[model samples]
Target: MKVPVRKQPSWFQVLLILPGVAALVVTFLFPLLWLARTSIQPTTGHTLSLHAYARLFEDSFYWWVIGRTIFIGLLCVVITVPMAFPVALFLARSQSRWRGTLTALAIAPLLTSTVIRTYGWMVILGRHGLINTTLVWAGILAQPTRLDNGPFATVVALVEILLPYGIISILSHLSRLDTELEQAASLLGARRLQVFWRVLLPLSVPGLMTASLLVFVLAISSLVTPQLMGGGRVFVLATEIFNQTTIALDWPFAGALSITLLGFFGIFVALYQRILQRVESQS
Candidate 1:
């Protein structure tokens, strides 16, 4: 008997992906190309120059801002992951009837405008805001303190805003986990904490890494929350880019800053891939 032959997908099947490819090129690739071109081009002439990059590297203030941005991103990841882990575990493992409602509640903040949420945080963290007023009323302090125009307020608001994303990422991974593994570990005389640390936690590293990456990128790229909550005190890259674009009308510098931010994205993504590879190899 002759060997059976397999048919390949025809041109029609390949054509189906063209629209998506076109959309990606238009939306992502085009913008990236524009940014790259603008970053090197002179503000007045068509000639290319590294002046913007030179200025960026030469300025100590810009270095400080970059360091601050990285610090805030790391801090957000650290705070958001642990806080989200329990919530995600509950959502994933719970058999409660109200699970859907609880999940909705967890993500409900995303429905509201970020501007409105930032403004709400402002009210809560302002000098005469709820915390200060309650503290003073309870005789915890003599007066209201300035809380809205600093890194503390920025981090708090960012955590609240970014928490849902972390929860969602971790929950996605947790939901797919095998309950049998935990049961087997328990059967082997492993305690609940041990089972989690040794089995579940190790398996859940990918989700945690994804959540951390999301929160870190969002925290670093965030503009409105940092701007309003920082009350002009915070100077993140996003805010600086906005300032360069709108206030200073320095489009070339703005583009350069944008490219720098893009570089951060690329660096983190590479780091995440490396870590993920190691985790998978060990597993």
Candidate 2:
């Protein structure tokens, strides 16, 4: 029998990818192109200039905000990753009834609006809020402290908001993994912790890294959490972008800032992809 060559993909198959292609063009590509154009253009008129980028780089305040944004994003990821790991592990390994309840509770926050969630944090972290009131009742502190308007509180809110993503991502990986290897490791003299650290965690690194990337990107782009929790005391790149576009009425500057933010996010994603590819190669 002669082997036949496979046919090329039909037009329909090619067209099937159009919606995603169109969405990418409209949502991501167009904005990115516009931002690049605007960045080099003059602020007052349409004259081409690199003044915006030059001025942006020269300003210490802008640099500080960028640094703060990165710091907050990293802090949120660090806080969420450890907490989410156990929750994800539980969800992946637990019996049906408990798993269902825990999964729902973990994902319920994902369905809520960002504004509403930030407001909830506002209440919880307010000077006279539940935490402070409870602390006072317990006599842990002499007075209620201002936690809502600080970097720490902003990070806390971001952690809460992004925690579910980390759990869900890692949960999928953990759930899909075959337990036979782990069982064999345990049977052979490996402790439970050793099996987890060597077999389970190494296998789950891809998912964990993906979750961290998602959380970091979201945290970097977040506005409401920082705005509400920081109370104008702390400024992040996203909030600064909003202010530049709306309050300052400087689209060019805003676009430049957006381009810079996009550049940073792109660098992060590229680095993650490189690491992932290296891991895959090694494996």
Candidate 3:
């Protein structure tokens, strides 16, 4: 049997796509081009130079910042996946009437502005805030301890902020899975733990990887949470870029930093795609 020939798009079809294409070009492509152009330009002259990039590379402090950023991203992934997995699994498998409400609650964090959520965390983690107040009242501490403006606060806030993305990624995959394989494992004398470890977990690797990638990328690129929670102490790439552009008035260096951040994203994306491909081939 001959396969049906695909039809070419009509003028009307092309017309409908024009506005979206134009918007993408205006919003994303043009800005990206501008950023690339700015990254190479000299601070004073319009002449192109790699001075900013060289400066970034030669500085040990910037290298430390890069490493710290990567560490934070990895840390967020490590914390988020374990916490999100159980929630995603429950949401995927539960037969309860409140499943909808539970899922909604899981994603409800996204509805609020990130700045608002970060401030909420500030209230909870501040020196005289809820945690310290309770600890002091209970005689657990002699005085209220400082919690905010540190790595601990930044990590905690980031984990909470990125948790929803992890849940959504894992849940989408889990919900699409064939349940029969899990049942079959159980029938073959496998215990619940054995079934999960041997069967369900292996199948869910793709979803876990996706969640990890999403959380890591977001964590590294995050500025506000780290800025507020870090209280100018935490220096991630995003915050540093903000400082370079706004405070330092080093537009070219800021552009270089932005480019470097994009490089990190590109490298991780390539690595993840390769790993995902290998996993898919094996499965």
Candidate 4:
């Protein structure tokens, strides 16, 4: 018997994909090229230079900002992953009627505007706002303290904003898990915790890792939440880029900063891919 050869992609298929390709070129490729060009240009001269990068490396303030951005991103991922795990597990394992309701509640924040949500957080965490007011009323403190306009509030708002994404990523993997593997583990004298730690967690590592990356990317790339919550006190790379571009009108400097931010994000993505590939190969 002869094996059937697959047909090549037809003209229609090419046409169908052409629009998407065009859109990508227009929306992403062109801008990326432009950014690359701009990053090397000097502010005073038409000729390209490495002055921006050299200056960035030399500046202690820039280093501090970059360090803080990475720290906050990692911290947000750490906070989000553990919290999201429970919600995802509940969504995956339970057949309860409240599952849908709980899931809706978890995701409902996503429907609201991020700016509005940040504002809400501002109200909640502010010195005279809900939390502090209530605490003071109950005599928990002598006076209300400033929670708004700080790094803590920035992370808190980011956690609240990005929680659903982590839950969804893990939930997708959890939903597709083989129940029989879990049953088999249970029959093999493994306790519930043992089965989870060894079997479920291993199986779910890809999803967990993916969710963590998503959280980190969102947290690091985030401008609005950090700006609002930190109240200009938190000087992240994105906010600095915004300042360079809009406030300072330094396009070349902004481009260089953008390149730096992209480089960091790329490094993170590469590290995760390498680690995840090793994990997958072992599994």
Candidate 5:
């Protein structure tokens, strides 16, 4: 009897994964490693130290900024999710010819640069701007109430940017929903609201959670919209990092801030994954 030889894996298939692996190593892993190294390097002392981290903890202001970032992210997601669901559900259920156009309209904001969008928001919500002008024209306000450079302005702009993500996430889930189950619920004498609550909502937990996580991550890390819309009043981790890196010429402090923000999101992601896995297994 002859000894059989096992066939080796194909090189072409292996080549396909190599590019992606290399990109992750180059873009993500190396940057993270560099940041960690820089974070440990003290500015004053030649040696590596944790002085930056200690200073961050010693300053309560940094903690407040962290809270603000999270709060703004939460606020944006909370407002966007409910609003996005109806639009997403409509997109999924509608058979109208104009549905494509409507969907495009919903997603159009994302096509433009974020800075341009923020500037557009400034014009619309500014003191002497469109909203004020229109309201003044309508005799609604005696003076143009300034929402320019405020959190409300930032939230509004962020909502416009973030809503598409939420809508798309929910729409994807809605499209894959089992219509037979919905029909069964309908046949069981469940009204529209009852059918939605008892069927669609339960099925959509995964999508909603995913959307929330994505929106939160994006909103928290975003720099331009907050910078322009916040008008320097909103001092977030990103802006703080910008200041430390560019303005103060402090790389170590910036690295510490970067790692701190990264760690928070990393913990958030880990917890999210664990919870998601549990929910999926239970389901």
Candidate 6:
């Protein structure tokens, strides 16, 4: 009787996936577990307790920072999305020559370091900087307006940094779409706007949601732009985390803040994924 032997799975497949799995576990999973553990620990003796979370709710300052962070994030998204749409459409639909050039230009800000970009904005919005000088020279204002180190300046810098993300995301979606579907819609007596609204918009929901969520998460977690632009006035969740960890030397509080922020952004991401999945199934 001849016995049949079962073939072993290839070692190459296991080798290929091992690095990614290891990286995920080491970088994200371990840190998240540590944060969760620390968040519940007592501040006094480093034992597990809910005191940090209770304290977070009791402290009005935490709530204030949370609300301000949300407000700024929404403002950034509102400004970035509409502005990026046309730019994304241009990059997606335009000829390769111009589209390539424009895409590079659009992402130029992202290529620059965040610190460098914020410094550039600082110059532009400073009292004695380009914007103020131009405004005064052109008689737009008699004196330099205090725009730097304010909510508006933070929003402006955040929007500039995150705008490229929205453009790139929507551009990827638009480029992947079938043009024939759009042509068919046009053939059915639809105008450019009509075709865009009826066909393009609905299909692009996943991408739009993705881009919005990206901007929202990035805006909320960001510290550098707010720190540089806030000038000690505006404080966000990330800044609070920084303060807790460094200035206050309160790791438990910082961990709680991290967990809270993670939960906040996690909800949005979950919602976005749910809606995106449903839309994908229907489409």
Kindly list the per-residue Cα lDDT of model 2 for residues 141-210, writing each as its tens digit.
9999878898988998999999999899888888988889888999999998999998988988888888
RMSD (Cα, Å) for all candidates, in order, is 3.2, 2.7, 2.0, 2.4, 4.5, 4.8
Error of 5 at 81 (Å): 1.0
Model 1 C-alpha lDDT per residue in residues 1-283, reported as the tens digit of each score: 9998878978997799889999999999999899889889988978899999999999999999999999999999999999999999999889999999999999889999889988899899999999999999999989998888899999999999999999999999999999999999999999999998999999999999999999999999999988999888899999999999999989889998999999999999999999999998987
Of 2 and 5, the candidate ahead on TM-score is 2
Task: Please give the RMSD of candidate 4 to the true structure.
Answer: 2.4
- For residue 176, what is the lDDT in candidate 2? 88
lDDT of 6 by residue, 53-106 (tens): 899999998999899989998888888988888888888888777778889999
Off by over 4 Å in 2: 1-8
Q: Worst ten-residue run, lDDT, model 1?
A: 5-14
**TM-scores of all predicted structures:** 0.95, 0.94, 0.95, 0.94, 0.93, 0.91
Candidate 4 per-residue lDDT over residues 1-283, each given as its tens digit: 9999989999999999999999999999999989978878877869989888888889999999999999999999999999999889989898999988888887888899899999999989998999999999999988998888989999999999999999998998899999899999999999999999989988999989999999999999999999899988999999999999999998888898999999999999999999999988987
Local lDDT at 235 for model 2: 93
TM-score of 6: 0.91
Candidate 3: stretches off by over 4 Å: 1-16
Q: Model 3, 177-203: lDDT tens per residue?
A: 999999999999999999999999999
Candidate 5 whole-model C-alpha lDDT, 0 to 1: 0.90
Which stretches of candidate 5 lie above 4 Å from their native place? Answer: 1-12
lDDT of 4: 0.93
Off by over 4 Å in 4: 1-10
lDDT of 3: 0.97
Worst 10 residues of 2 by lDDT: 38-47
Please write out the lDDT profile of model 5 over residues 103-155, one tens digit for every residue. 88888878989999889999899999999999999999998898889788999
Q: Evaluate model 2: give its lDDT.
A: 0.90
